[model samples]
Target: MTSSLRERRRQHLRDEILAAAQALIAERGYAAMSMEELAAQVGISKPTLYSHFSAKEELVIAMATQAMERLFAVVDDGDPPRRSALERLADLLRTGVQVQMDRQVTAMHLWMPEIVQMMKSRDESLTQLCRIDAVVVDLVRQAHLHGEIAAGLDESVVVRIFYALFMSPNVARLSLVNSPDPETMPDAVAHFFLRGVAAGKA
Candidate 1:
């Protein structure tokens, strides 16, 4: 019981730290954000925060990884996946777009140069990213099989388009036309995935 309680406390602290780091990075970008401010925002002393994360880079890595874990969790709900492949694909896009905007950050901000280099250097992280890509590719195939995606479009083309849509939110910020708000963007992207944009997808 004591060990369990200690583990719970540790998990709780880690969660709080990750959240604080994400918020700070979102508001100020990782480069400009200070560790002291992050600690203060979380109502913890610098030493306490350091105990959880040895350095700002480590905290940034952990925060980013946790966000990806949550993204993966959205799709990994069951053995066979509780949702249809198309639905899961949509969910993944939606979650990725929503969290970044809601937290008020950009994809580039989260993926800074050193952080990108770090992830690239880590074999495990690369494998995880590739696994996600494979899952998404499988979903595109399933979508085609179900007649959900347009026929005659190359599977590779459809997959590439889907990947493009995942990053559409980053582009949406620059649009002067009717851009979907966060609440509506997911459905809008799903529509665009199934139907061409000219077909009146939001």
Candidate 2:
């Protein structure tokens, strides 16, 4: 069914608000982002912003939830034995990194203690995150079975480490050399992580 004209306009504004929120949260940590600032940045009144999102936490949760929904849709599961577990894992990592780059924020931002705490109360956001983690856990197990990951590394630890690598932008900032080009960061990061956890490397 087609959306009514008013509904379409409302959704367009909602998308605009979420895009602004992503950039603001990327520039300032979520703890520092304010609804008032977001409203002003979007050229909307506070009441207008509040009309779409009831609260700051709700808005942030909506943004993060949308992100996870996109990630869930695009990540390949490497079904039917077409790819090695290692290959599949690398693809997943690259997709995730590329997503953060596109959004100008990292998953690490969403995993911050305060954000995580806030998200616990948002069932849809929490569920989407769990779904992503579940896929990662399965991939890690498959990698281990295929002798791709280093022997004896705990699956949970590997999974956590995989998530931690999403913070590569912070690490890149501290580098003496120039940061990895955004175009190559996905492959560079995926290679770095996979090599670190390779069967004989760990």
Candidate 3:
């Protein structure tokens, strides 16, 4: 009973900390939110926060992993039979991107530098990212096989190309210039992926 109570309290604290961090990120930019401030916002001591997450970077990584898991769930839960693989893939990508843009883009941008560093330093995170890439690649390959995408198209090339187009311009804009025009990004990316890379019909 004691152990179970401790575990419940631990989970509660962790959830509170995450909630505080997210609220702070929404209010101020991610760069501006400090660990001390986060702890205070959560009504926890600094050491308590540290007990849950060793550092800000680790906390951010955990947050990002949670976000990715949610995205994967969205993709997995999508209708497969009713929709063509191409349509399903497009819907998944479009919906996933839009959800991130709406829900977590600011946090993502704020943590990107640290996340990139984490990816380099942590093999597990790198592996997870690769697995996510493989899922997208498989979708492309299946689409081609089913004739939903053009025959003879290189799936690997298409996956990489689409990944680049989806992540680059929006992320760059969020970092360098300003927040992206959210209205157009999803449709634009879906159309680009569904259509040929060249200027042609989708």
Q: lDDT, candidate 3, residue 65?
A: 71
Q: What TM-score should be assigned to candidate 3?
A: 0.75
- Per-residue lDDT for 22-125 in model 3, tens only? 77887897779999999888888888888898887776666767656755785677555676667767776776567566655454553356566776576777
Worst 10-residue lDDT window, candidate 3: 103-112
Number of the predicted model whose TM-score against the real structure is largest: 2
Tell me the lDDT of model 3 at 113. 62
Count the clashes in each prediction. Answer: 0, 0, 0
* Local distance difference test scores for all models: 0.72, 0.78, 0.70
What's the lDDT for residue 16 in model 3? Answer: 81
Q: What's model 1's lDDT at 75?
A: 70
Instruction: Sort every candidate by TM-score, greatest first.
Output: 2, 1, 3
- Cα deviation at 58, candidate 1, in Å, is 2.5
RMSD of 3: 3.7
Best by lDDT: 2
Estimated TM-score per prediction? 0.78, 0.80, 0.75
Model 3, backbone clash pairs (residues 3+ apart or across chains), number: 0
Q: Which pairs of residues collide in candidate 3?
A: none
